[model samples]
Structure formats: structure tokens, C-alpha cells
Target: MRLENQIAIVTGSGGAGGIGEAIARRFVSEGAKVVVCDIDEEKAQAVAGALGPNATPWACDVSRSDQVEAMVAGVVPMFGRLDILVNNVGFTVPGFLRDLGDEAWHHVLNGCLSSTFYGIRAALKPMREQKSGSIINISSAAGIGGAPGLGAYGAAKAGVVSLTQTAAVENFKSGVRVNCVLPNAATKSLTAWFDATESGRKTRAAIEAYSRCGSPEEIAAAVLFLASDDSAYVNGTVLPVDGGLSSRVACIDATIE
Candidate 1:
């Protein structure tokens, strides 16, 4: 197993088939102990429960610095090692900047971008002390270019990419690797949302790289690579598992009107 005896924390791992849960499952299957962290305690427990003993449920609102800090502090003492940290918590509200409300704006910024900051900040101490750790921040293709109705989300995700690179550079001397992933997961909710609206359907149809959307498992595979020794020499990389969405103009909207 690539991650044998490793300890990992995967935030936003509550949803049954979301990318976070898929990552947690992948980590555990590879012989790592994982903390299934999410804001929803019940959902966290549910996912953790299914993953068995190697997965522990952790109720954490990653957007809250206090909660994130506390969670990271508790990991090493409990697991005896902090090997991998996947900052996978993110959500978005769709609206043009002009029409975007304050609450929606802050929520998107805090949840998607600030949450990444909080996780990385808290996890850095332990990873630095250990002298060997991997931190993978989940970014998005939305951050790559113009996302018409997703202004706040795009900005926050863009921050994630910048933050990942800066963290990687800062931690190089400490033997810690920080990377980022732009994953376009074709999870149930996303598929349904796309199917429910003509614009969403058009957006899905615009994907040029593959005939189908990338699965959660596929995204997990990319993340597993960055988290394990396989990526020992790799650092500060922003890998896109978005089926080439970031490459060209897939500017179709998956926004709520």
C-alpha cells in the first residue's frame, strides 16, 4: 500500500459520493487511517461508519478557523502522525458579481477559499515538525478563467491555487509538499443539477476532452497520487482532473438563474 500506516484528514467528506468521501475511502483502502471531517456531524458519522475502523468521524466547519485549528491539533496526538492533509472543503453560490449578495459572497469566499487557508495554516505546524507531509488543496477550473455567474466562487478558487503554490515554496525546506487539484467531479448532485436545466445541460455537453464527466473515483485517483510517496519529488503542482476543462473555452454556465 502506498500510504501504509499514514494518517490523513479529508475535510468535507460527509456527502456519500462526493470527492472528499471518495478520497477518504481511497486513503483508507491504501492502508492509511483517515479522519472523515465535515460540518455535518451525522453525515460525517455515516460516511466514517461505512469506511470502518480506519476512518474516524470528525465534525468540523472548516470555514471556522477555530474548529479547523482544533481538528489539526488533535490529529497528531490521536494518530501519532500527521502524514497527509487534503483540504477538500468547498461549495459555491452562482450569481454575477453585480447581483451577488453580501451573504452569498462571504459564504463562498469563506467556505471555499478561507477554509483552505484555515486548514493549511493549522496543518502546517504538524507537517513542518514531522519533516515529511503532503498537503493537497482542492481548487477548481472555475478559477482558471472566466466563470460568468460564479464570480465569488471563481475568485476564491483562484486564491486556492495561489495559496497552494506559496505554501509549497515556503515548506520546501521543511520537507513538506503542498499541491493543488482542479477536480471536475461528476457526482450525483452535479449531474442532476446539470440535467435539471437547459444551461446546465449545455454546459455538460460542452465538455470536449471526454465523452463522459470524470467520476469521483477518478478524482480520488489523482489525489492519491499527490498524497502518496508517488509524488515525493512533486510540489506546488496544480493538476487538473477536469477532463481538459481548464485547457480551452468550456465557458458554458452551470449557474442558478
Candidate 2:
């Protein structure tokens, strides 16, 4: 019950077996009231309903800043106080950097990076006034380095990390801890990407470092740590729950002269 009596908002929390849903469940199990938000109204309601009365469903497009702001503004009125916000809304259409169309490029950036900005910005005001809150952002391992076809996704996710750090520094004195998590989980969307296309399957097979996909529960555990007071002294930290794939650099060959 680390989050007993607390109110938390977890975005993109509708998909079955998604990271967002896992996080929402973790929060509720710890005694926090969670708002399960997603682009799809039915999905949002389903997840929330299954979580029981402590969970409420919210439907909105986080890529739209107006919707995001409005949602955040309504939270305090509904729940009385906001304690945590998990920016987990993200999507991407994988393709090569040079071959990507403008629409896809912008789509990836807006959904992944801009959406993160909207959530953090909207949550900051209430958190600042209360002088206590936690904001956990979900980034990706692709952002840490180059990926075969995740150029747009990588770039957008990279921005998320930078934004989290900046927000953390600015809100340090205000008691609102901002942190980011890089997760490599075997969620529905991720698995679909690899299984839906031939190129995707090839890429998945070739990648040895991250061949082992972690469960969504593992990622939820990291988010819980960041959301709770256990990480009170921690801020502006980018934690990797990617099973060390990001740090797996190839062994350089050197000949002794």
C-alpha cells in the first residue's frame, strides 16, 4: 500500500496486456485510485471496469494538447488531489529514416514526443501548487541508440528523455519528481509489430542483444518504484528496464603490436 489514498493518472492504459494497463493495475493494487486513459473509449472503460470502483476510465487523444490540459484540469475536481501522472501514450510506424514520408514522421513525433510534453506540462501546475507529486515518463530503448528502422521513433523517444530531465531540474525545488523509464516489454503492440511483417520478423531475429523480451509486469514494477516515496530523493533519472540491451556494445577487436 505504498500509494494508499493517492490518485494516479496513467495514459494509454487500455490495450490488453499493454504496459500502460500493467502500470495502472500496479497502482491500484498498492491502494491508489487510478484513472485509466486511452484513445479508445471502449478500451478505456473495459480496463477501468475490470479494475473495480477505485479505477475510472478517461478517453482522450493525448497528442492534442487541449484535450490533455482539459483532462488534467478535471482530475483535481474529480479526485480532490493529483499525486502521480504516468505519461505512457506512444505509437510509431516503423520505416527507414530517408524513406519516411512527412506525415509519418510528424505522426511519430507528435504521438511520442509532443504527447509527453502535454502530460508533463498539464501536471506541473497542480503538482507545483501542492508542492508534492511524481511524474513518470515511459521512453524507449531505441532512443538510447540507433535502431534499424526506428529512426522516427528513436528521435521522438530521445526527446522524451531530454524533456524529462529538463522538467525534473525545473521542478526540483517544487517537490515534483520527474523521471523516465526505458522499457523493453513484450506488450501486444510490440509483439504485433514483429509478427505482422516479414521485415519485422527478420529484424527481430537478427537482434541478439534484445532477443529476450521482458514481461509488462517487470516494467510496472519500475514505474511503481518511481511513483512511490521510495524514490523521493531520485529525480531526473532515466532508468532502463531493457534487460541490459542498451549497454551491450560489441567487443572491439584489437591486435597487439
Candidate 3:
């Protein structure tokens, strides 16, 4: 068991078919005790119940630093130690920059970027004391390369990549590793966009042309690899589990026309 006897926390894991839930299940299957943290109490409880003895539910609004800190503090006492943290709580309101509101920008940054910052800051205390821990942050291919309608989201996710690198360098001497995964999966957000907009359709087609779209489980595999000792030498890296979608140049030749 790669994570045997380890204790892990996965935020935003309450959604029925989301990546966070998948990661929690995968960790439990690998013999790790998981804390399913979500803003929705009922949903978090439901997922934790389904995972049986290996999981516990914690209601937390991760964007709130106080709540995040409390969650981390509580977990260490309950589990005796914290071995892993997956900052998976994030969402985006897709819109062009000109059409996006100030509130929308704040929402994206708070949910996607600020929440991750809070999680990492809270986890660092326990992790540094243990002198051995792994933190896996979820980023996006949109972050690596700009997306037309997802500018705010892409920007926030890009911040995640920067934070991951900085945190890795800061904690490496303490035996803690920080890395991030840029996943291109058919998530609820993507599916909703695809159903509502023509641009979404084009984006999906382009992604599929580059590489077949993936599932939450496939993304979970990459997270697990980083969370385990198998990736001891890996840190401060942005691993794109995007089925090669992020490896190509999507721009057209300006001189062709």
C-alpha cells in the first residue's frame, strides 16, 4: 500500500462526480485514512460514509483562512499526524474579460487561488513539524495557456503553479514536498460550459484533437503518484496530466493569412 498508515486531507470532495471525491476514494483504497473536506456538510458526510472506516467528513469553507487553519489543527490531533494535503477546491465563472464583473474576478481568485494559499499555510505547521509531508495542488491546462472565456480562472490557476514552486523551495529542507497537477478532465464545470456555449464546443474539440479527454480517476492517479514516496525526487514541478493537450502549440501562423 503506497499510503499505508498515512493521513490525508482532500478539500472540495463533496461533489458527486468531482476530482476531489475521486482522490479521496483512491487514497482510501491505497490504505490512507482520508478527511473529506467540503463546504457542504451533507455532501461531505455522504462521500465519507461511502468510503467507510477509512474516511471522515469535515465541513470547511477553505477560502476562509480561519476555517482552514482550524481544520488543519483539528486533523493533526485526531489523526496523530498529517501526511498529505490535496487542495482541490475550486470553480470558475466563464466569461470574457470585458464582460466579467469585479465580483466575478474576486470570486475566482478567492475560490481558486486564495483557498489554495490558505490550505498550504495551514498545513505547513503540522507538516514542518513532522518533517515529512506531501502537498498536491490542482491546477489546469487553461492556466498553462490562456483560454478565451476562462481568463479569470486561468489566472487564478496560474497563481497556483507559482505558489507550488515557491512552497516547494521553501519546504524542501524540512522534508516537505510541494507540487501541482494540471489536469484536463471532463469535469462538471467543463461539461456545463460545453452544454451552454459554442466556444466550449470548440475548446472541447481542440482538446480532443490533441488527446482524448480524461476522467477524474485518471487525474487521481497522478495525484497519488505525487503524494507517495515514488515521487520523492519530484518537487516544485507542474505535472500536466492533460493527455498531451498542454504539450502543443495551439496558435495559428500570423503570416499565413
Q: What is the lDDT of residue 34 in candidate 3?
A: 98
Residue 238's C-alpha lDDT in candidate 1? 92
Error of 2 at 108 (Å): 1.0
Better of 1 and 3 by lDDT: 3
lDDT tens digits by residue: candidate 1, 1-257: 98999999999998898999999999999999999999999999999999999999999999999999999888889999899999998888888899999999999999999999999999889888879899999989887877789899999999999999999998878989999999874588898888899988877776633446888899999999999999999999999997776665445646597
Q: 16-128, model 2: which lDDT tens digit per residue?
A: 79999999999999999999999999999999999999999999899999999999999888998899999998878878988999999999999999999999999999989
Better of 1 and 2 by TM-score: 1
Minimum summed lDDT over a 10-residue window in model 3 is located at 248-257
- Number of clashes recorded per candidate: 0, 0, 0
lDDT computed for candidate 1: 0.91
Itemize residue pairs with steric clashes in candidate 1.
none
Candidate 2 residue runs with Cα over 4 Å from true position = 192-199, 202-211, 251-257
TM-score per candidate, chains pooled: 0.95, 0.93, 0.95
- The RMSD of every model to the true structure, in order and in angstroms, is 4.5, 2.5, 2.5
